[model samples]
Target: MLKEVYGNECSSRTQVYKWFKLFKEERETTEEDPHPGPPSTSKKEENIEEISKLIREDRRLSIRGLAEKTGIDKECVRQILHESFNMRKVCAEMMPKLLTPEQKESRMKICVDIPNNIDIS
Candidate 1:
């Protein structure tokens, strides 16, 4: 009946059966139950601040080193660095993934200088 009414827009028969069973059982909401696990705070403001401070103090610090120093999980440290701080590893050192205005200007100057400083004649 669902396939006839909704055609391809209808969900699979198994899913429809599951929902039907739930509805018949008087389930109030269709939402899935909350997942069971310890809550995560690795990306909390305090942790971000600590991670940022550590990175600023030693931009060469490896993710493993930061994890050890801060006692945070390595994966969490990596997420905080990449997602929150917008940084990445470059030549074994932590560096901003994107260039700042000053860095951009400096890079432009270097690129411009190569042509002017060289003898094209």
Candidate 2:
């Protein structure tokens, strides 16, 4: 039996029958025929731009919030944030993976200020 021999690698019995029928009909190849469908529209340039605008407006917005606001899927939103914008979440806010010079300087100032401002108990 295919179940015993092939385990999960084999197709369903119905699909095997369908393929057999196709082969009997003189189908040249075992590969599937092309079936046209509507184009994918979710991850377009427009969507990328919209996401960029939303992030600039509020860096603290989560992927779920972005998806709801843009009517995009959560995974797609996260992909856009990571791949398109090169961003990641830090302290519940989206930030670039690489810091800008100004941002580095600002962080340095904050780090220096923190130790100076702390008082011994």
Candidate that would win on TM-score:
2
Badly placed stretches (over 4 Å) of model 2 are 1-39, 114-121
Model 1 residue runs over 4 Å out of place are 1-37, 105-121
**Candidate 2 residue-wise lDDT, 1-121, digit = tens:** 8578545755667766665776678665433743122234567899999999999999999999999999887998999889988999999999999998999999999999999999988
Alpha carbon lDDT at 9, candidate 1: 51
lDDT of each: 0.80, 0.82
What's the count of clashing pairs in each model shown? 0, 0
Clashes of 2: 0
| Cα deviation of 22, candidate 2, in Å | 14
Model 1 residue 94 CA deviation (Å) reads 1.2
Give per-residue CA lDDT, model 1, range 1-121, as digits (tens): 8578546755676665665676688775434733222235567789899999998899889999999998788999999999997888988889888898999999799999998899876
Best candidate per lDDT, number? 2
Write down the lDDT that model 1 would get. Answer: 0.80
TM-score for each predicted model, relative to the true structure: 0.56, 0.60
